[model samples]
Target: MSIEVRSLSKRYGRTWAVRNLSFEVQPGRVTGFLGPNGAGKSTTMRSIVGLDRPTSGEALIGGKRYAQQPAPLREVGTLLDAKSAHRSRRAVDHLRTVAATHGISRARIEEVIGITGLESVATRRAGAFSLGMAQRLGIAVALLGDPHTLILDEPVNGLDPEGVTWIRELLGSLAAEGRTVFLSSHLLAELALVAEQVVIIGRGELIADAPIAALTAETERVRVRTGQLEQLLRLLAADGVQATSLTPDTADIVGLPVDDMARRAAASGIVLLEIAPIHRTLEEAYSELTREAVEYRAGLTEQDAS
Candidate 1:
């Protein structure tokens, strides 16, 4: 299944929560939906699953609106809230209740319980379950239908380290089976590890929608350490190449690969001790992408922490 968000927008009275956003989540891949706080990520996800009606445009699954699906859960499984189960219901009973409406077999429910590692807490009441257990239960619910598309929001919000690793691998395997997995999380590093494509929105608008490799590649730079750092920087400035000094003996150059930098240095008679590409982490890339779009600004800085 494929997800298509075409010109999607949502409004809350006088405030516009989302505005003219557009992106697609392809099948057989994991796509990360990212945004700063109050950037309308929740609103978009809600619109996608028909929980909230959009003020304009549409959110579609396989070219049809979610409401058009015969068995919505089986077509697009969602985990919008971990606390969605009835408070007094046993975890296993809750799964059965949900599955009953969709005609899911008891065997399938049991299989999903094992798949989400909820077999240990299968009979526990949801009211007494910890947040992590609730998350697992919610995942079990999403998987009960064997859906083709998985739309999960903050799926690892309360998971332990092991649970986190397990969910990461599970998502990868699901996409490998040609499922469409669209998820939102604040865990940028983990998203970078699992998601092949990223759709980032900011201030209720589409900011970037690209492959992870392409975004990180756009930010790649070269670090050159040399006794003649100053001279090389001066030459780069004269030649219209941008470079920033990171240390007394090293300068970071952008817009040029390491081989190109080495060639330039050799042509200029600059002695270099080290020259290597600096790859930006997904966190760094996200910070840069959403810097101007964050609604809440913090007073604390790195200097203050240091």
Candidate 2:
């Protein structure tokens, strides 16, 4: 299954929650939806699942709108928020009710319950369950109907390291089976590891929609520490490379590969203390993108006033 959001826009009076945002989530891959807080991530997801109507445009699943689908649950399994289910109901019972809606068998429900590792607390009331347990239960409910597309919003919240790992594996396997896995979370590090593509939004507009490798290509920054740090800096500077000195003997060089830096250093007889590639973490990449946007927005505001 695939999702195509075409010029989707949603508004609340004078404020636009999402504005002409467009992207596609391909089947058999995990597409990460990312942005800062209040960046329309949740709003775009809610609109996609038909929880909220878009002011214009459409979020289509496999060529049909979500509402137009004969059986939405059978086509798309969504875990929008942990608070969507009844807190007092047992996890199994919660899934049963959903299964009943689709005329699904009880045996299938049990299978999903076990698959999500909810069998241990299958009978426990959700109100008393831990947040991680509740998240698992939520996932079980999403999987009940055996939908081809899974849309999860902040699914890793409150999960332990083990639980997080389990969820990650489950999603990867699902995608490997040719299902569409579109998920949103603040956990950029985990997303970087799992997602093949990313759709980043900010202030109701799509900022970037690209493969993980492309978005992270700039993240391959290398730092070189050498005895002749000043000489190495001057050598690299001739090529218009900006090198920053962190210490008397340490100069952090970015925008170039470690091997190239080493070659340049050796050509100048610059003895090295340490030369290693410093990959910018996912956190750093995300922060850099959002920070640049913030500065751009600030400049726009100033220009408008002037």
Candidate 3:
């Protein structure tokens, strides 16, 4: 199954939560959805699953709207909120109730409980569960229908390190099994580790939709260390290369290759200690993309001001 958002827009009175946003999430791969707070990520996701009706445009799953499907839960599983279940209900009863709504069997409910690692807490009331346990129960609910597409919003929130690793591996396995996995998470490093492609939105608009490798490849930097830093800087300046000094002997070079930097050093008689490429991480790339689009900017704290 594939997810397609075509010029989707949603409005609340005068404000547009999502505006003219469009993207396609292909099957058999994990696609990461990323944006800052109030960037309309949740709104777009709600529109996709028919939880929020779009003011304009459409969100499609397998070439049809979510509500158009006869068996919606069987086609798409969603974890929009971890605290969506009744607090007083036992974990097993919660999942069983959800399954019963879709005519799912108890065997399937147990299968998903095992899949989500919720067996130890299955009989425990949801109110007594910790945040991680609640997240597991939410995932168990989502998986109970054996859906073809899984949409998870902040799935890693409140998870422990072990639970984080488990979710990462589970998502990979699900994608390998030919299921479409679309997730939104603030943990950019974790998303980079699991997702092959990414869709970045900013201020209710589409900023970037590309493969993760391609986005990171555009901002490669090279770090170099040489004894004759001033001479190296002068030489690099002549070649129109941008460099920022990190230390007296080391500088980060942009718009130039490590091989060229080494060649320049050798010709200038500068003793080179280190010359290596600095791969741009996903966090850095995301920061650059959303810098101007961030809705809220934090100012200096009182201690810093003092």
Candidate ranking under TM-score, highest first, comes to 3, 2, 1
Q: On residues 155-185, what C-alpha lDDT tens digit does candidate 1 reach at each position?
A: 9999999999999999999999999999999
RMSD in Å for model 2: 4.5
Whole-model lDDT values for every prediction: 0.89, 0.83, 0.90
Return the TM-score for each candidate structure. Answer: 0.89, 0.90, 0.93
Best by TM-score: 3
Instruction: Please provide, for model 2 over 9-79, each residue's C-alpha lDDT reduced to its tens digit, 9 standing for 90 to 100.
Output: 98889988788999999999999998766678888888888888999998999998888889888899999
lDDT-sorted candidate list, best first: 3, 1, 2
State the lDDT of candidate 3 residue by residue for 56-110, as single tens digits.
9999999999999888889999999898889999999998888988999999998
What is the lDDT for 106 in model 1? 99
Model 3, TM vs. native: 0.93
Please say which candidate is ahead in lDDT: 1 or 2. 1
- Candidate number that wins on TM-score, 2 or 3: 3
